[model samples]
Target: MVVGLREVAERAGVSVRTASNVANDFPHVAPETRRRVQAAIEELKYRPNTAARQLRRGRTEVISLVVPEISSPYFSELAAITVRVAAERGWTVHIDQTDGDADQERRMILGPAGRSVDGVLCSPWAVSPAELVELAAGPVVLLGERETDGVLDHVAIDNVRASREATLHLLARGDRVIGAIGAQPHLQNGTAELRVEGYRQALESAGLPFRTDLVMPVRSLHRPDGAAAVTRLLEVEPRVDAVFCFSDELALGALRTLLEQGRRVPQDVAVVGFDDIEDGRYSTPTLTTIAPDKTQIVRVALDRLAARIAGQTGSGAEAPLDLVVPHRLLIRESTTSVRTRKG
Candidate 1:
């Protein structure tokens, strides 16, 4: 037997509208009435018809979070945070994975999947700013670095700054001939490009020549891709002293490869990574990484999306917001307290 709003209203000795106001968290409800309605709801285990309520209120009470790959630890953790934050605000979240396909991402942005939700939070890798503008489905807040043309809400850290800091840390430890792994030159993603630019900037600042051979490109930011890139890096530049990976997943794979090849971490080669994922913390050597404030990112993105959903933008009165969350470089065993040798 399903308990409905009418039962709750009768038990609370209030009208249907009053019970609804309490259930929906309307500000006009009195404290005494709210207490009675809440007590009745608990006693009867009343579950509101969310779909119907949303329809009547002209909202869906649902948000969509789109990422490149749900299996990736960074993306999965982000999605989990998004779901938790949305739930706290009495909203539901739907997750979509695009597998880093441009057409698929475009479809997700413009197709039915994007239209079904009240708003969308996306971390697009392949979709361009022009494409987003032309095919926008609804209210959107981006989670990663993308050129949004000042029209879409974006929340991300300064990828270039963080990457530069990571590389400079490696350089400060007396490591030269540092190989950069996980460059996605083919994708032309802003994240990859920014990270690479940062790495080059650090090298340039340090008076180190940027060698094309030391930069290893990968098709995906996956474990196997990282391992393969590292393998090639070792094969060509066998004396490379350190590597700065663009992601923790890649760093883990690179660490594994180094271990398999009988190379001592931070002794023969130092390693650093971005996107301080959990796996990085527990890895054998404990990865040093750029840790973005994920909590703040989720909070800001949700707050902005909620505002947009409430029609707060108000007829193009305000410019779209681009929030750059703070990040820090965590120095772990992977790149600390080790003697550096010139390779």
Candidate 2:
């Protein structure tokens, strides 16, 4: 005894075709008719069969969101938002983690499992520009990464701008000789290169000499990597008073190392980090960092994906939305003023 579309149409006193048109948002349907159909649908609680609808429409009504890693708060929060937004739009969301490995990334994009989803929203690492171009064969939205050759729609914060702002925040606090713990150097894609460029820009703007030794590049942007990077930075620049970690995970590790070394945060060394996560807020002395509007990122990304799934390629939803979410520096107790005695 389940209510179906026909029952809804009968309850609304409209033909099945009219009810279908209303549900589909066809412009030809009158507003009163549309409202009536909606009211009937509400009254009947007639949930549309998603599988049937997809099969009829030849769409999966599913979007794949692939990330490099999810343990990081940034990716975890992003995934939550993406799932929420997709659910709101009545689309299913699937997650894939590639561990930032090149082969894994390519397989996710080109392999059979990838075809199960209607469209893809990817934050790829180790994916070359050429591979990205090929992956554009399917409807794809790039997030948290740079677009290669403008082949696909992308939504991202301006990494260079965010990085430059973070650096300037430290400089404004009267800290020179800023050290950076970031991902690998000469990376072809992703946020690392953009952040490095921004770091250089900040130094150049302040007439501070950029030292190659201070840019301690690491293989991963994980917490352990951050700890290792901090050790290297201090070794390279013994008098470094401030550091800008490209990620919060790395910054957390850096803080741990500093604490173990008997250095007081902000009192001995000030550290700034990107992607202001919860750990940053509760960490000892707290962490100063940059935060992006994750809510906006997920909403826009899901909307773009939904539009693509519905086969409304050009005008309905896919409108070439290359957006950059705004970011701000969140100054906390971590970076106050350096008061370390040169040993």
Candidate 3:
């Protein structure tokens, strides 16, 4: 006998719609009710009719997850959670890497124009805000911030605040003459800009003057880029006692270079990074960094995308949904010993 949602609902003692909501991984379901529905589903061995549902809804039930580089530890971790969350929803995800290319990002953003993909979840690097508004075809959810003025949904932590907190931590521990790595002034995504802004905010709040030479802009947020930037900072600002890197990859690279240049971690120079990747935890001195709740970020973005796919339209539909998730600064062995503040 062919099993359907009705049987599951009956077993779970919930309405068919409630069972469907649970099956679809739609938010707002009570935890206990959802548990019962899921239990019933397992007991009945009910497999959802994805194809039939797709045909009825005219949806491919697939979304494109575009990122600059999937190999980047931060993006890789983020993508892993995204895939898992999307799978629970009975949806498929197509991973596309643009490598922060302008043309590639443009294609991913506009590719879903009545195409196979139902929506797009993109962490764009090069696409401008004007281009995004103009090129957006279907329900597109940005994985980062863009200051798009209600033209897009932003699922991210407050980059400025996170960056500022990390910087302030180092300052509180008596590390002065701190330098920041990772500023992409040429990009309009605003992620890099926001992080740098936070760094500057922390510096200003501590009565330290921001210097053009102390902030380094990078072509990319990778190990080598971080290494090169730190080398430059050391050369330009020889008295640099600490550094704030924008990404764990950069921080790792900075740590390597700092070691190569005969600087000791936290003893001579304290370092902090963002995006708490796994490698940071095992590095020689370990990395002090910011940890964003990746699971929350993925789930919220997918939930909003599902609503959009369901044709969310109303007076407030055009308003931007900027959800700021939680983030915390993790102090690790990299800053185990605070550098003595010079009198």
Candidate 4:
């Protein structure tokens, strides 16, 4: 009782080739004809067999999403959104995690598995842009970072702007002697560089000197890194009034360290972080952080991959394809007053 392509083509008054063209979204088909074929296919509930389609088209009809750390809520949330979006377009998502390891990332890009996917959407923590560009044999979409040379479709927030805005928010509240938890080479994608630029810009704008000692570079994007970074920052500049963490996880770690050190948040020292994560909202004292449209970013990323898989191309075609979403400050209890009163 299954419907076939020939039945749908017959109902639409089109040849099998014409129906195939409509399904593949081949250009040059008349709009009216395309509409009729689409309508007939929908009415017949004709689900194209992926294996048959692949055999005919020489494609797997699969898009791969490569991330550095799947365990991180940020990446996992993004993956979830990407899957949902791809599913809507009759596409499937293949998720691969590299655990932020460079060798694993290299293998993913250079290995045969990379070639099996029709398109790729990735957040490279260990792979360099140059290497990514070389490894990409097909359409590649880079997320969570800036696009280099229009190498492929990209969807991201401006890290520099987001970081600067977060720093400025703290500065606006009269915070001086600001501290920042930075990332070392252990992390990826020049994130630390861009964020540091933002922090420096904020300080420059406020006529405050950029103190190198106040920046503590951490080895990872975990709570332990935050804790260790805080310890170093306090020891280097014990009287620091504010701290900006590169991520919410680090901020949580810093929060734990501050509590253990008997320093009250927003009282002894104010703290702010990037990535307005779920845990940040429900922390002991809610975390003040920068918020980006994560869901929207993922949605756009998946749509771009789908389009690329369907052979769509060029800038500003079919949709606003390349995206750099805006970021906003979400103030919370963690970053309140700039000054504390001694009783």
Candidate 5:
């Protein structure tokens, strides 16, 4: 015979309401009553119907995480971490990719997918703040630097500061003609813009002229894009001593191109990258990079989403929460040596 809540409650000598409260982990039940209910539940091997419980509470216990590209190591790794974290909290995670298209991103933000999920966690690449505010009808926690007018929960690293520090590290190593290999001038909320601004800041502070030609603009931060950008950099500024790519994917591509041209890494041209993906570590010449705290990002984003799902929020008048995680510059063999002569 099947064990039910009523039988368990009767066995524990408690009212059905009290037994239900104990089963749901409600905080107000007396200690002895909780113990009795738990004992009865264990003895009977009672199992609550999760779907029924969720239906009663009007919650799906599901969340959606949307990113620009799932194929990218950074986004893929983030998805893995999010899945693990969501499982621990008894919630299911759904992954979505937008391919960095404005229309697709907007649809994912405001369409049926957004409606079905209990909440959303998104690293929006092309969605505008106005579009989001007008269309978004669910709880959302932004993953990157999307300008949301301080009206939504956001989690990100200090992109400007981290990029500036990465540039300064290259400068400190005596790389005078440092070329930046990722610039997306089209996107308003582009991370590349912030990174380039930091690169400029570091150049100006170091009394080095910021060469517009050295700022290689790419359509995307993919490996092919990186390879093409580096090819252009080599053609225009053959004497460039160091290159800082906006992402490891780009850096990996740049590395391959440099090798094909018989250029020695750190000897002919030092290389640095952002987003320390695992590929960076195992590459022929390990890449130096800005390593964002992925674990902390996952933790904070999930925690904020969980709070939102549970209907927890600050006073209506309070500003939306923006959490900035920390980052570190990992110096590796790619930028190990200081070149006396320019490439």
Candidate 6:
């Protein structure tokens, strides 16, 4: 009961090769012939074998999206956008999670990707900077805060700027003694380091001295890590009035711990987070966060990848090697309107 390409061709009164060209969307078929084939396909309810079609073109039309953890809300939403966008262009996205493992990232970068996929979109955590240029010589584009050496095709917001903005928001709302959570001093990850730098910059600009006691290091950006780090922070710095978390997950966790410990959000301890995830919108006080434009990130990434696949590196149409997308600070109830106006 299956309607195959051969049947579709017969119904359209065209050769199988002609029908195939149409199905694969290869150019050069006469206009009338294309209409006939499309109509025949519709009438016969023909479904093309995508894999076989792509293989004939000497391409798989598949891309790998590598990330530290897809389970994270930020990454989950990003992967969803990537998959949806890739499908519109007749491509498939294979999501590969490394759990921030260096060895896994190394293997993925140096392993079967070249043979299996047309390109790669990665948000790397543990890969060394030296390996970044090598990653770019292939069709690899990074998705997050990484020191790409201007050689790799990278896409990310300015992490330092975003973090500074988040901190300044809390400060503007009359909250001082802010604790910074999610500093990964133990890892080679540039994201946490950049965020901490931004937090420090904001404090410095506010005439607040950088305090080592207020900067909390975390093993991960998960809720539990946030909960534990904030707990320890609260125990030591009982007067901490605000916290700028590196991720919404951490912020949510910190929010929970603060409320449980008798601190009211905004009134007592304002919270700001990055990665404006959906949960933030529905949290108790609703979270304030830095929202990166995920759809734009995926579109730009895929566009760059397509250019790379076509060997369009030197073409003037190619985008910048290090592209920065747009992000906005979304304010919510978690941060009250400036409790005290600042100059």
User: Which pairs clash in model 2?
Assistant: none
If both were scored by lDDT, which would come out higher, candidate 1 or candidate 6?
1
Backbone atom clashes (below 3 Å) for every candidate: 0, 0, 0, 0, 0, 0
Model 2 TM: 0.80
User: Model 5: how far is 85 from its true place, Å?
Assistant: 1.7
TM-score per model over all chains: 0.87, 0.80, 0.81, 0.79, 0.83, 0.85
lDDT of 3 by residue, 1-343 (tens): 7778999999999999999999989999999999999999999899988677877777887988989999998999989998899999988888989988999889877875346678889887898766786887788888766465667887889899999999999999898899999998988788988998898899999999988789999999999999999999999998998999999999999999999999989789999999999999899888999999999999999998888877644444556688888989899989885445456
lDDT of 1 by residue, 103-157 (tens): 8888877774454678888888887765675777678888877556686889989
Candidate 6: tens digits of C-alpha lDDT, residues 20-46: 889878899999999999999999889
Between prediction 4 and prediction 5, the one with superior lDDT is 5
* Cα RMSD to the true fold for all candidates: 3.9, 5.4, 7.5, 6.2, 4.5, 4.6
User: Would you list the C-alpha lDDT of every candidate in the order shown?
Assistant: 0.87, 0.81, 0.88, 0.82, 0.87, 0.86
Error of 5 at 92 (Å): 1.7
Clashing pairs for predicted structure model 6, backbone only: none
Return the candidate ranking by TM-score, descending: 1, 6, 5, 3, 2, 4
- Check candidate 5 and list the clashing pairs: none
Candidate 2 lDDT over 1-343, as tens digits, reads: 7877899999999998888888788899888888999999998998877667767876776778888887778899999888888888777788888888877777776652354678888887788655775855467877877645556667888899999999998899888889999857645566888888899999999999888889989888888999999998888887888989999989999999988887778877889998988899988778999898888888777767666656645555444557777778899988874434557
Model 5, poorest ten-residue lDDT window?
Answer: 311-320
Best by TM-score: 1
Model 5, span 1-343: residue lDDT tens: 8777888999999988888999989999999999999999999999986566666776778888889889999999999999999999987888889999988888887774444678888887887665665666777888877445787778989888999999999999899999999998887565778898899999999999999999999888888999999999999999989999999999999999998998989888999999999999999789999999998899999998878766744554335688999999999989994435545
Q: If both were scored by TM-score, which would come out higher, candidate 3 or candidate 6?
A: 6
Give candidate 3 regions above 4 Å deviation.
1-56, 312-316, 337-343
